[model samples]
Target: MGAGPVYGQEVVLTAEVDLAEIVRSKYDFDVAGHYSRPGIFQLTVDESPRSVVARKA
Candidate 1:
């Protein structure tokens, strides 16, 4: 992946899972299918010059 610092605007992360067997199987909880579960991903972003505001003392 190319690091386009000057060109990059924003970054986002998304996750999803398959709910086929998980819906029918009785595996305690709904977790029968092996897929990418929706989870929270933290990403550090550098704000643009226009978006960043300087605090005046």
Candidate 2:
């Protein structure tokens, strides 16, 4: 079989907040399913300003 897909570089960050917990607590949302499957969530610096203001308000 041919190669399944081409892969690009990857970057990982260790942030202070637990992203999954924040999403569940703030929005009542869950990225991982009932079995706790792994998933990806993307947050960019562009959202930082708006997020900060939202938290303050």
Candidate 3:
């Protein structure tokens, strides 16, 4: 997980997951054994500003 403040916008939180790890954990499968393409995920959060901000000192 990663976070950063966006000046005038809401804070951003980023989470990344590896598809190969998911398959290996869920079904005991190895992506390396089969032909698979690499994958990456990026998600964004845009909601209440108050909830995302931290009080300034």
Candidate 4:
């Protein structure tokens, strides 16, 4: 939890794999991975890659 304020992200993706690239380049994680299954994923990023793509979107 937060002592005062905190920002968090939780991603459950079924498609839109393009967003996955943005996330892969942005956040630094200690330990992370995926299942062999194709579309199932858990992902997020803190660097706000959306800002990089916002103008295009």
Q: Each prediction's Cα RMSD? A: 13.4, 17.3, 14.6, 17.3
Per-residue lDDT of 8-46 in model 2, one digit per residue for the tens? 855553446556876578555544544344344555465
Shift in Å, residue 16, candidate 1: 2.2
- TM-score order of candidates, top first: 3, 1, 2, 4
Using TM-score as the measure, which candidate wins? 3
Error of 3 at 26 (Å): 1.4
Error of 4 at 9 (Å): 44
Better of 3 and 4 by TM-score: 3
* lDDT assessment of candidate 3: 0.60
Runs in model 4 lying further than 4 Å from the true structure: 1-17, 27-57
lDDT of each: 0.53, 0.51, 0.60, 0.50
Candidate that would win on lDDT: 3
Q: In model 3, which runs have C-alpha deviations exceeding 4 angstroms?
A: 1-10, 27-57
Model 2: which ten-residue window has the lowest total lDDT? 33-42
TM-score of 1: 0.20
Poorest stretch of ten by lDDT in candidate 3: 33-42
Clashes of each: 0, 0, 0, 0
lDDT of 3 by residue, 4-57 (tens): 655876765687877798667866645554435335433458775575567888
Q: What lDDT tens digits, residue by residue, belong to model 1 across residues 1-57?
A: 334345456765454656785766666544534432445333468776564577879
Candidate 3 at residue 16, lDDT?
82
